[model samples]
Target: MVKGIPVSFGVGIARAVCLSAKETQAVHVDSQPANVEQELKKLHDSIERSTAELNRLHEQVSQEIGAAEAAILDAHLAFLQDPAFAGEMKTQIQEQQLYAVQAVQQVMEHFAAIFESLDDSYMRERAADVRDVGKRMIKNINNPEGDAQEAYTEPFVLVAEDVTPSDTISLPRQLVRAIVAAKGGATSHAAILARSLGIPAVMGAGPELLTQTANGDLVIVDGTSGSIHINPDEETLARYQKQAERERAEMEQLEKLRDLPAQTTDGRRIELVANIGRPEETEAVLAKGAEGVGLFRSEFLFMDREQLPTEEEQFAAYRDAISGMAGKPVIIRTLDVGGDKHLPYLDMPKEENPFLGWRAIRISLDRIDLFKEQLRAILRASAFGKALIMFPMISHVEQIRRAKGLVEEVKQELRQEGIAFDEAIPLGIMIEIPAACLIADALAAEVDFFSIGTNDLVQYTLAVDRMNERLSDLYSYFHPAVLRLIQQVIDASHRNGIWTGMCGEMAADPLAAPLLLGMGLDEFSCNANSLPRVKEQIRRMSYESAQEVAKNALALSTPDEVKTYLASL
Candidate 1:
């Protein structure tokens, strides 16, 4: 068995099918100067054809999936139209006397390497797009007729060095049984797509697997265990088959609770919602019986672009999510980029500690124009459905007041322009910083509600960067201090007569459910796939018992002590 990172949670056994990235054709330098004009024409024509193909795929994907996922193609389309990019390639061909295809390959590598070297994970992932576009151009020039469309007649485990966003969107879900990638993390686009589709995936399996495994070999991928078994014996296959059957049965049991309310055995009601990044995910959330969207990551609209998103573009994306939810509350978090999520267009200065530096609300507060654009967009979207705006990384009462002040300014501007909006819309703040938790009472009075972003709250509380793999053991969400802070935030919100919800990784854990529910958390938001299991967990216990467990957990000194106490309940 080979160990790998478990990106998506599931188990699958299938025949392996290895996929290799297209290699650039070798180009020999000309002995004499080639006609520069002829090379330029050929390069221009290839770019046009590539743009047209991308446009066609974009429309098809938008119709089949949603526009949010289709927007991945937009980055490629923009690259094709970029004069600087074209000029660089043209210069390489003309000045270096290299073939058009070689010039494209060289330029793409140069730019892609820069992106890969960035500290931000989001920017690093974009390097894949650079390579993808270059491959498309080279393929277009080499095979102008476009080879026949590829199809899979049977289910197979897909093995690749790395999976790009475009590849994830284009593949037929039914034909791909599972994914084993040599590269990628849990937060990568390929992993996100696999989880959304309920496919088992093991990423970062190492390059050696790609070299050792042959196509058509039987393999078992256990996403839960983060292990792969190659060419298992009959007895081993039978054991895995049984395990897969158990997983299916467990899923069926969870689905039975989908239509039921997320109420305790003693009849205490709690709202269970889903956290989504795009408008398209609302369908899955609704299918899993989510009452509303606890968190809509609005920063996704600004990513993978060279310029800031226009107000109209943001409005349309926001409106699509609001309309899709069909009156269910959609709490959109405004522009939480910084730290691990850096945008290519933003001119943010490098910081020694970016997570604690200029990020989220700090950036928005400094760039009021950017903040105003997002506020205006959310305001316009509110007219269509139940929309609430949330501010992230806010630590002080002054920040909340300042942000609310800007909200008022945008509202008045829209009202003067005669644009209809929901004037009574609720605004909220995320309780992530330690400073915010210590004074939750003061901050609670300023906003309509509070959402605990425990992902950051845990990191900040433990002084461990969650992104740092070396500190993984220290970054425990179940740490006593994190729980104490959560209890404090919830209690503070209740004292102020406002509802509070948790939209973080902790809210999704089944073991953490009892502690949170007992702490009187008004709402719980998690990934759509985890919604049913969480709802089922909520239905199984009495509020009184959960309260006892939470009370005991708070007294524990260590994370292990708290976990042991919670597990016993």
Candidate 2:
């Protein structure tokens, strides 16, 4: 009767059949000729194919916090390519005469031990990455021809202690109605992808779920509320089934709003856009009435999969985004990987201040190979549709200049190769850092648009880490300084005849909507589900009136006052 923290909500009862990573028999491969590289090659080939399949699933369906997924593939790629790591395994295989799968499993467990031994919470999280790859490798070897599946699709929910990228990929999207697991954080990979795909899921269910239910039992999953009900009585089941029908009916009604212009009750037009990660997310935008893609995170293309996505792969991804937008503007942000975001292949040392380290444009400018590859891909994809490039974490004028130079260099190469591209793609910068926010006027003059990323903006402005739940309350977007900086960037972008947008959580708030509208933000982007509610609020107030509301908002001393005054308007 031990209760565990419920990270996700939904009650599902399934039979107790836990699939754990298995160990292998010994093989003495060290005694074989040191040149038995063919065996290592075979292992690499299997992992590579598995990686390809995993990446394909990522492209087709959404999982939770998929950013961590790239970390999983990256760790596997690292393990596969690591001469020392693979060398030790092969040596053990020869010396001990072990089974191929078992030998590979043991070596992976060894690396998992290292990550588990780390003291830092962030680094310690890497243990999951190690185990994910390890299990995937064993799965590949054990059932080399196909996934070890007892079912394909049954419209049933999967309840597990945990779920992985491999597990999600192996499931048929149509058959699986929802997913519930007992472990994983809010930003866990399972949760993030579920949000992307619009699947109803709940994770971290713990023992109460496993101990209470059996497999093949009917259940209800309330993703919106994170609740699970098992074997509902006839009346209860009928009620929930009715609720589900109503929800579907309501969603069908919203579909009619897709192409219609977003106008407030007062007749003020508000731009409604989608926050997308890859080109795949563009379809949802078009389906949900998005005028365009407001935030196209390029990080998805750069990370996650084993191989560095080639220019063609990136170009295809970008091309798909542009074509899907159907002439609507796609504002693409160049790689924003840093701090909590990592590429295992990069070999970046553990840093004390990852937030301030080689990240975003800083890393791009320094790593010409990585940066140029991405820029070329975007430029090539630009020919397919309207495309704009935005640089992230631009704290200094010099950084922007350096990044621009690389873009120019890429343009030159395209010219040399006689490849066509949008020669006049609009360039933008994310004014996220305080230094960038304060100096927005200069940055605005140098770029075509400015997007205020309040997630990092609030964190950087307040000197508080948003991930630190202990100080989460202290992470305020309503701080006077933060508002001032937002205004500064907005004012600067407007002064330069460029439009401004805020893609952070602040952009979606009903209270802050009036303030941002007053500050002259030309566009607002947020979660697709939030678009209607925010648009509804905007339609209630005139553009001129929102300006007045924002003016009064600046004088407020507390977050509550800001909220009250805005609502009063």
Candidate 3:
């Protein structure tokens, strides 16, 4: 058995099919100075062909899946068009007299390394994107007619050192039962695409996967538990075969609930929503039966670019989301850039304790110009549909008041300019800081709603760095203190006649569902893939039972005790 990070949830049993690592590995090829111009031309032509391929893949993925998943190809296209990326390769070929393939390999590896070294996990996953583009460019350079597609005659588990987004998307979905990679994390584009495509996937399994597993070896991939069993004993195989069938049945049952309301047996209806980063994701969100979008991460618009997004650009993105939801409320979180999430264009100072330093609401407050631009754009977009504003990492009531003041200023400016917008649009703040949780009541009075960002809340409440692998056990949403803080925020919101929603991993957790429901959480927002399962869990229990579970859970002494208690239910 091998342990890995589970990116997509499911169970699969199939014969192993190992993808050759040599296909992705770059080979060095030295060229002569006289052939530099020719090498450069080859490089340019390869990029053009890669661009066309990505464009076709983007359209294909958009049609097969949704626009959000297809958007992953946009990064590949961006890299192909990026002067910095192509120009670096051109320079390598011209100055170092290297072949186009070698230039691509070297320059891409250099960029991928820079991304891998970043403090941010999301940015680190981008290293895969860089390497993926390089592979495509190399392939196009070698075979301009395009390499023949691999034809799979039987269903098999795809084992690779790592799979790229393009490769994952281009795969024959019906024949690929699951994917097990020795590299990659949950945030990699490949993982994201797998989840979007509803395929079982286990990533970051380490190098042992390729070494130990052979082609035609029977493999059991328990993606939910991140366990891989290679040529398992008869007893283990039988147990997993049963589990796989159960998983399939459960998936079919969940699909039936997609169009149903997320209501408990006792008739309490919870607003089930999805957390999305881009406008294109709205299609996936709605397809999963999300009542609305609880968190539209506006920071994505400000990232992977050379400059701040103009008001019109921001407005267009927000408008697209609002329009896509077709009047379902869309809560747009303001620019929460700082800490691990850095923008190259923004002049932010490095801090020793970045998480505790200038970040989120702090940055927005300090940079009034950037804040108002986003607010104005959001407000203008509000006129098209039900749009709300949310501020993240607020430690006190002052931050909420100050942020609200700027929103008012934007509203006034829009009014003066005679622009149409929803004057009564709701305002909300993310209760992620321990300080904010303690003063929930005070903060609750200032905002129309509260969305607890438990990812950071768990970190701040326990003083645990969530990104630290060594301390992962200490970083849990099931922690007693974390649960109490969440309860406190929910209670405070209800007391003030405002609703509370959670847009974090905890919200999607089936084990945490009953406890949150019993705590009277008004809304549940998670990734689109988890919506059906979460809703199914809610539909299975009565509100009274969930409340009882919550009561028992709150009395628990430790995270394990709480989890054990929830599991027993």
Candidate 4:
């Protein structure tokens, strides 16, 4: 058995089929023609062909899996359409006199190397996308009329060194039962695509497993535990088969809990919501029985574009999410465009510590015109349904006051223009930075609600850089200090007559459900797929018992102690 990082959550048993990029021979590029314009035209044509193919794949994946998986193709499409990237290729053809294919290969290698060198795992996986696009372009150049689809007849688990977004979308779904990758993490595009497709995946399985197993070997993938058993014994196979059956049955049972209130056995009700990235994902969120949207990331509208999204464009997307929920609260977080998420036109400086640098509300405050446009859109969307505004990475009472001032300014402008809006829209701030947590009481008095963004809160509190693989051991949600801070945030918010919710990865964890419940969190927002399970966990535990668990956990000094105490519950 080999251990790796669990990306998608599921289990499968199947014969393994090894896939390696190295196995595919490099395409030969004919020498550059004397006519540079002809080579440039060839490059443009290849890009167009690759984009058309990607669009087809996007639709195919959306129909088969979900819109989120298909959205991965959107990023690819953006890269293909990026003028700067294409311009670089044109430069290589014009100045270096390289063939169109050779220029593509050279640019692909150059940019892929740069991406792979990044500290962030998500950013690093982008390198795979560069290669994927390059591969498509080369194929089109090599044989424009050739078939793009690669077929495999038999059903098996796919084992690859690295699974790209395009690779996942293009794979024969019926023939691939599971995916075991030697590289990637939960946040990688490959993993996101797998989860959207409901395919079990184990990422970062390391290089040894690739060497130990041969093609067609019997492989058992336990994605929930991030373990892969190669050529398991008969007894092991039987156990895994039973385990898979149990998992299937449990998922079916969990679906029955969808409509039920996320109430404790003691009759305390908890709000269960979803964190969505795009407006297109609202249907999936609703289908998962989310009562509302806890975090509607507005950055999606701003990303992957050459220019800023217009107020009308923003309104349409936000309106879809708000109206789709049918009066359920939608907490729209304003554009959070720094710290790993960059826009082409933003031209943000290269900060030494982006996470702590000018990001989130900082960017918004600095660019009031941009901030006002989004606020106007949110206010306009609020007229359709329950819409609330939430600021990310807020740290000071003054920042909240300043942001609220802008909200009022926009409201006045809309009122003067006789534009309809939700004048009573609730405003809130994300408790991410430690300074915000410590001063929660002061900040709480200024806002209507508090949503703990534990993903960042934990990292900041524990002084651990989660993107660093070596620091994985230290970057834990179970840390006592982090839990203590969470307790403080919840307690402070409640004291100020405001409810506190968590819209982070921690809220989705079933094991942490009791901890959060005991912390007295008013709302639990997680990924849509995790809603049923988290709600089920809440239903099984009594609020009083959860309180006791929290009380005991707070007394613990170490993460292991808190973890052990929680496990005993």
Whole-model lDDT values for every prediction: 0.83, 0.71, 0.86, 0.84
> Which digits, one per residue and each the tens of the lDDT, describe model 3 over residues 9-79?
78888999888655445554544453888888888899888888888898787666555566677677878
Ranking by TM-score: 4, 3, 1, 2
**Candidate 3 clash figure, as a count:** 0
| Model 2, span 416-532: residue lDDT tens | 999999999999988889998878888887888888899899888888765543354466788778998898888888788898888987775655787887777778987666575
Per-residue alpha-carbon lDDT of candidate 1 for residues 1-569, written as tens digits (9 for 90 to 100): 77788777778899888875543343455667667777777788889888888888777655554444566677778778878877899998889876788789888988899988987544665687788788878767666676423467888888888876656666677777788888776656667667656788988888877876788999899986678888999999999999989988989999888889999999999999988777877887798899999999888788766789999999998999999999999999999988866676889888767788899999999999999999999999999999999999988889989999999999999999999999999999999999899999999889999999998999899987665443555778889889889999999999999989999878877778988998999999987777887888789999998898889889889987887777676
Worst 10 residues of 1 by lDDT: 20-29
TM-score of each: 0.81, 0.71, 0.87, 0.89
lDDT of 2: 0.71
Report the number of the highest-TM-score candidate.
4
Task: Give me the overall lDDT of model 4.
Answer: 0.84
**Ten-residue stretch with the least lDDT total in model 2:** 7-16
Where's the lowest-lDDT run of ten residues in candidate 4? 20-29
**TM-score for predicted model 2 compared with the true structure:** 0.71
Q: If candidate 1 were superposed on the true structure by all CA atoms, what would the RMSD be? A: 4.3
Using lDDT as the yardstick, the better of models 2 and 3 is 3
List where candidate 4 sits over 4 angstroms from the true fold.
Answer: 22-25, 28-45, 56-75, 87-101, 115-126, 139-154, 172-175, 555-569
Task: Give residue 288's error in model 1 in angstroms.
Answer: 3.8
Error of 1 at 26 (Å): 5.7
